[model samples]
Target: MSKTILITGASRGIGAATARLAGARGWAVGVNYAGNAEAAAATVKAVEAAGGKAIAIKGDVAEEADVIAMFDATEAAFGKLDGVVVNAGILDVAAQLADMPVERLRKVFDVNILGAALTAREAARRLSTGRGGNGGSVVVVSSAAARLGGADERIDYALSKGAMDTMAIGMSKELGPEGIRVNSIRPGLIVTDIHASGGQPERANTLGGGTPLRRAGTAEEVGEAIVWLLDDASSYVTGALLDVTGGR
Candidate 1:
């Protein structure tokens, strides 16, 4: 059977790109979106046009009920889930910790950290259903800010992504015994809406110039990396943080 993949927050940007590429490669895709049902449908149509099967699923990754529904729906759509891209992350309001609101901090944790955790947990839960079986792979989305610490501008965003990186490493260790591989993708200076939302539109230009590659990365670039990480071609790789930061 062809492998099946699910991607969260797949309405646009990196998640959408991953969905497109994975579908193009003949993997059935579960294109998930939180707020935009229309965009999700469009993504599903695009995936279908690429000669792969797909379904649009709506769910807020931070909400447990929503996440559960998403997983159930995804499994129903694609049969066994061979992989999942936990790309449903959020950026915090740009400001220093001293000036940041506690509510904003909570929202960041709720979406980025908790949402990634929820997706990871769901994949782990399903993987656990069949002990010692050939389980799935997961690629959690993180940010280069986790290592560089984009504080004074995006402290909360960094914190959330840092947690994902740490969690992926630990989860990989635990899930490896069950044949489930876990990894994270840390993107740097990707020209995505995430930077603009973080109050750092210039982040792309600044980091791009400073990066060894000297160019802002595209969503397609990161998406291609994510697909490779989940493919059989990447067997023997686990508990890794693949950097798609243009060598930054």
Candidate 2:
């Protein structure tokens, strides 16, 4: 049977690209969107057109109830799950740390940090409970800002991503005992809605110059790396932080 993989924030950006790439690899993908029913449906249609099965589900990864429901729906549709891509996250208001709003900092941590943790936990539980106690991999989408500090409206974003990177490191060791692999992809400046969300398009231009590759990457490029990590091609790789950044 083909593997079933769940991806959060599938409505746009890297999430959408992952949906397309994974579906093309013959995985039955569960496209999880926070809202945007139309965009979710379109993603499903695109997958179907590529000769893969997929279902669009609306759920917030930060909420346990929503995560449970999304997982249940995925199991019902595919009868099995092989992996998950923790892609849903947000950047809070951009500002210097000293001037950053407390609410904004907390909000980013809630969704970007806690959200990935919640989703990965459920995936670990369900995968462990399945046949032979074998487990699936969880690929978290982090940001390059985690390592490269930025002063322009990125304190909260960078901190949250840093938390996720450490979480993946711990999870990889903790879950390995159960046959599960945990990893994270720290993406460089990708021309995605994340720029608008973070309120910093100028950051993209600056990072592009600083990177070894000297250009902003595309969501498709990041998606390809993400899928490769989940695929059997990377079977021996686990607990790795793959930087898809253009080298920033």
Candidate 3:
């Protein structure tokens, strides 16, 4: 049977890449987007083109109702979810902590931290063997910033990802015995539109220039790592943080 996976923020960037790759691997994909219906549709098309089943789901992860609806829609389309990719996140323009407004911090945490936690909660309820569900996997999209600390650049974003890292560790221990595996991927500067959204279109190249690899990573590269974590190939691995940072 084809496995089913719900990928949040799958309209573009790393999420889209993961959806495409997962589809190619014969998994049914639920491409969840925040607002870009066109991009989400395109992702669904790509999945179909890859000889896999898919559906485009619209929802705001920050809203609990929307998150619940997204999961409901996914299950309706695919019957069951074998995996989920907590990839939805955002960062505003770079700013120092002292210069940032409290609203900005709240928005960042709401989407990145609260959003992920709610999504994971739903995943646990549906995927936990102890909860009368089949075993499943969850792969969270964290950031290198969580370790490096965004500092003057994006402390809020970094802190949000740091929360995800800790959640992955704790959830892994809590869910592993229940046959649900949890892991995280900390991507370095990957060339994705998320940079442009953050008001730095060239940030990837700029940051990658300083890395040991001397080049920016691609969305496809990170996608490969994500799929591995969701697959049985990494069955023994849980609570592990895989970095797709080209050794940065």
Candidate 4:
């Protein structure tokens, strides 16, 4: 049986990689993008090329209506969802908390916290066996910054991710009896455009050498972890935080 999944922020980076991997496994995918239709379309094409079905969904995760619509559109296109990857997140230019403006903080929290919460809430509504739907998994794309504390860098980003970690654990425990599994991935120093968006195009390569693996991780690496959690192979797993940090 072909399973269906929805990956937010799937237009690029780890989300795109996960979509492709899931597609290769013959899963139907919903590729959700906030404002990158071209990139989202490209991901949908890649999923189809990989022998799976895909659809490009446009919506901002921060908006409640948009998040609900994303799910409705996916289930409408591909039927019930077996999994959902809450991969939508945003990071501003690297700066200490003292130097960051209130607007920047709000923007980060709006997407990373509010958006993620909204997505997970809907997943619970749709995937919970107690809610008249089949059981499924929810994987949150958190960050290594959560544990690292961000220090002199963007502590706000770290704070948001820490909140994600808590949410995943809480959801897993709350929904476990209802047959919904929840987990999170903490990716470290992965080579992705998110670095460029953070005003550090070379951040991963530069800091990767410091890791015990002597290199930065790839989006595909993190994607693999996410896919594993979404798959039946990890049936016993829930509330776990898998780190794709290459031992960073």
Q: Which candidate is the best by lDDT?
A: 4
- Once superposed on the true structure, which residue ranges of model 1 sit more than 4 Å away at CA? 129-134
Could you tell me the lDDT of residue 209 within candidate 1? 85
- The C-alpha TM-scores of every prediction are 0.95, 0.94, 0.98, 0.99
- Across 97-170, the per-residue lDDT of candidate 3 in tens digits comes to 99999999999999999999999999998899988777889999999999999998999999999999999999
The Cα error of candidate 4 at residue 196, in Å, is 0.5
- In the order shown, the candidates' Cα RMSDs to the true structure are 1.6, 1.8, 0.8, 0.6
lDDT of each: 0.87, 0.85, 0.94, 0.95
Clashes of each: 0, 1, 0, 0
Rank by TM-score, descending?
4, 3, 1, 2
Runs of candidate 4 exceeding 4 Å displacement: none
RMSD of 2: 1.8
Query: What lDDT does candidate 4 reach at residue 245?
Result: 94
Ranking, lDDT, top scorer first: 4, 3, 1, 2
